[model samples]
Target: MTDFVEVDTAAGRVRGRWRPTTGTGRMPRSAAFLGIPFAEAPVGPLRFQAPVPKAPWEGVRDALEFAATAQRGDPGVTLIPEPSVPGESTLNVNVFTPDPDAAGLPVLVWIHGGGYFAGSPASAWYDGRNFNRDGVVTVSISYRLGFDGFGWIEDAPSNRGIRDWLLALEWVQQNIAAFGGDPSRVTIAGQSAGGGAVLTLLGMEKAQHLFHGVYAISGALADVSAERAEKFGRGLAAAGGVAPTVAGFSSLDEERVIALQKKATELGPSSLGSIVEEGLPLGPSVDGDLLVRPTRESLRAGVGADKPLVMGATDDEFTMAFSGVAKKLRWVPKAFLLNRLGMPKGAMRPYLAANQDALERGTAGIAGRLLTDRMFRTAVLNIAEDRGDAPTWLYRFSWPSGTFGFAEHCLDVPFFFDCLDGPAMVPLAGPNPPQALADQVHAAATSFIETGDPGWPVHEGDRGVVRVWDTPVSDVVDGYASVRALREPVS
Candidate 1:
């Protein structure tokens, strides 16, 4: 017989399973209630609409298994073992708690990353047992992905995926207490696109009540404009032979739309240039209603000034992706490639000079570094500066992957989760990642979630003091000085 733990939620009773702690989590075992629906699946009438709360259920629902995810297949974007589950009802949340009956425990709400188009919450790397053991109830959530979630339809709403996130947080606020989580002590965190989601949420006035703090890891901000979003939507519809309306999209098969989205959003001749110039084809946009203005603008206006934030990116996120071109483009002038990547002529020399270490790696390495710096590192600095001393902490994951030789994207996730022993760690973090670094990173994360500070120096007035997460983790001054060229007008 399966031994199940039952917890009564606002809508219904759920039966979850208990597993012994995998690594060195303090608790012996923690309960995981997977696939608890927070909203009706965005199908039929709900397609492309704001999430509607799940209706109350009659009997105890078994949450022993993971739920369906909007991401339908292995897209290789997340770099983790993110599985795609199939079903019409895909709007759900998975809860991992130390004790559903306990009172007033802190909560960590996680969002996953996949460039706003692909990613799944159902990844082993995200299981929250370690957090649960440490007294932080953890929740990983799912949202609509790609064109279906972000594509503009005249009759339907925009930013459906964004809406899904809002509704999921609302669910946490209302029901997390039933799972032994304190409603007031919730902190939202995520990597990549998910990191961007938390930042977006942090800047939302409507979302200020949902979570108390944020920790964004290598966030890839979308901030797509309304005009661009509409254009992408029209292009997607043209590719699918459908109208840019609810009726046309609803008539098409979900699988067909999925296929069309990729073709429609494929990168052009200059992949890096396209990403930097056009930005993601689908993601949270300035809808003038829910989103109001852009995320940075919202932050600048002090929309969510009260909440604490901790954010950073790996030193070489995705730089390794361009390593293969190192030899082929060895002789290529770094300035020429930066020009091709759409960096202004005025900015090329200065940008290249600022990133000298990357410059030494030849063309491919330099290009990759520019891509990471432009897309992620610069964004971090911008957000931190825009935030204007609102209780912020910054850090850089500087430890190169044991296998990849670069810090790389997704490398710090297992460390953040304190799950270096997790099944997916080796592929990204290599065979023997330093357990001590994981201890430091995870400890900081747990500390921040619990006390609203990551136990490091706070980012004040662009001092550039940042925690360098490598061997003998230590604080440094102006740690991000290398990327300063992109921050200012270089002529």
Candidate 2:
């Protein structure tokens, strides 16, 4: 039988449900307080503003279901599954705890990824039950997305989504103790754009002391300049036929705003040539306030020097992203491919020698590899190098998803959450994925949350050791040398 429980939060009394543990007798059951509002709904006049704390409710608000996601396009187009629910209070968090009465347990806060445009905490793969069973209190959060969250508006706060993240962390600080979590022992983590969020937060002074450590999985860093942000915002306003301000956006119907945002994003590749040429659009911007500089520079200046961190990307971070597009590029000329990839014709010599089949496959494979290195892998390594003073553990998720030959982006998420069996994970993980890998990833993550270490030597100086998560997991120093050598310096 499911057990129902209630906890008094800063906002009001919330009713939650308890799901019995499916583990051995030693494992503890977990309580789930879902759809707990951490901030006021960013709707109507509040839209595009920094998150405000939700007003206190009267009594016994049902916290039994996931909240609605921020406005987004259909999720079917993305590799990761994004389940949408319906509600206005998208600035909410889901808390899973071993025992609501227990105190001082470590807390793990998760931010879901959707390319800064889509995704929600309601995805089945994000269930925090396994975390609770392991004696950790897990909190998964939802924030604004797409134009509503990241779009730059003249009258609205920049990085509103990031602001939502900070507000949620503040909420955790204020209320997690009642859910059996120690606010002082918080570790924030995210995958893909969420992972980017982790790194972004690390670089922000506003995020100081919010969490003791962080995990960035397949993190992709994309920061737009104010000029670029304003240009994109103006274009979005033009597309929507509204003034380039929060008031104009607020006056439009919510669905109409979402539709226009979708159109703007779809036009990003052609309209926002500067960012699209670099394979990025409508993400975090250097707003000169919350994020005073680029994230890498901020880290180099010691923004996150005190926190322990675990950061890495998959071997083929963009394999899934390139799957369909690659197939269509088979007939494209090699010279054009070389030019587009910023590599001279003979530059393919080393890659060709490494993969004999690359020639037959044309530039698709090479392009995917280059994109992976430039967009994800190099960014992660750069962060590691800059934050060398901190206790940082690096990793490479090499286990391939059966659907894609390489370790695709978002593939490691289920393993990290130990939710491979979640309904939405089957296609990504395949049936009968290696449970052993899941155990190793989950154990290491739980260990990090509890003690700020992930069972590996700290990466230091030139000889940075990296944990390779694959069959027969092993550690190697400077494993990224080949790709790093080929990587162009960040612009």
Candidate 3:
């Protein structure tokens, strides 16, 4: 039997469906309002500008299915299963709540990750059933991706994707009360690129009012420099046979634009080494207008010092990429690879000496660990350190996956969502993922959203503590000490 419900929003009336949430922490009366437009379709004249508010409509619109995603088709880039739904109305939000009549519940708004180029809000893994059951309203949102979102143009506004996020959060503030949520208590969270989004928002003065707390899992910051962004933008325009302006780009087919942008960043055999060394070409750029400064600089200058933040990275994020190439890398000198990764000449020996265990796994293992630290862990330390005395918490997902034998990237997301049984989870989390670990992660996240703290001690000073999530969770002082070498000033 189908159960139907309706709610009124600032835009219009929306009809959603109710369903039962089951399993270890199951609850009843959870309802979902999927595909609610937070902004007008970013097509035609709105293609390269900031998001426009969705025009109000009459009668109750059915929000039963997921909306169009910014990612065109299945790109198979990410481990999470984010299906692509095609349409112009890609700027949408999916809401899951326990009750529409109930009030004052905290709201969690999620942003999916794909290096700011590709990712979907339609993933089954991102379902808010579990969160709704826990007395919180969950909302997963969609934003523009790739060149369309972040690429620089001669006359177009920069950081269109970021603007999409702000508008969606504004929508939550204006309309979430109808879904029984407290807009004042909104907590923003995401994984990987989405995690990067959380940190970006944390440091953004314009975003401070939209969200109060943040949970950034394996956050990857891109803060692309204006020079690099301009270079890449020019290269992309040349490849597309168009000018770097709205007039020229508007001439080419959308498919041509996508192909040309991809061509600008495509990796070949030789470029693989520089993957983490050279930062991403497209993402939240340090535009002079909206983003007046780099994310770290903003944080260091006491920006967003008042918000509570919980952030962590998996033990071996991005290491699995090297699992099969160990033999090929056997003969290559580790020092050469380290140099190629932009490591300082003097720090190579010390960095290797500090990671003796990884050294035992040979050159491939060392390379993987270096890449992991350079790309993920080191940033976690830098952000925590930059925050100083602010309410910040650090953690490490040290539990190795049963299948891959390493605590890889994107592995902790299902655990964070507490959706162990969601689609495609087994392939990443192994056949039997521990129920208890999910419980711990989810509970801590919930606590952070509902309250301010995430259970463990707040990070304090240089040797702050980090909560390590393994089979038997433990809190270690200076848990990120291994990465201090990367933090050392290069001679």
Model 3 misplaced stretches (Cα beyond 4 Å): 24-26, 272-275, 489-491
With candidate 3 superimposed using the best TM-score fit, by how many Å does residue 99's alpha carbon deviate from the native? 1.1
> Which regions of candidate 2 are displaced past 4 Å?
24-26, 72-74, 267-279, 325-328, 333-335, 344-347, 351-362, 488-491
In terms of lDDT, the best-performing candidate is 3
**Comparing 2 and 3 by TM-score, which wins?**
3
TM-score of 1: 0.97
Clashing residue pairs in candidate 1 are none
Model 2 earns a TM-score of: 0.93
Model 1: ten consecutive residues of lowest lDDT: 72-81
- In candidate 1, stretches whose alpha carbon ends up further than 4 angstroms from where it belongs are 76-78, 344-350
> What TM-score quantifies how close candidate 3 is to the native fold?
0.97
lDDT of 1: 0.88
Q: Give all candidate RMSDs, comma-separated.
A: 1.7, 2.7, 1.7
lDDT per residue for candidate 3 within 366-436, as digits (tens), equals 88888889899999989988988889999999888888777888999998888998888767878898989
Q: Residue 192 in candidate 2 has what lDDT?
A: 86
Q: Give residue 291's error in model 1 in angstroms.
A: 0.9
Q: How close to the true structure is residue 307 of candidate 2, measured as C-alpha lDDT? A: 89
TM-score of each: 0.97, 0.93, 0.97
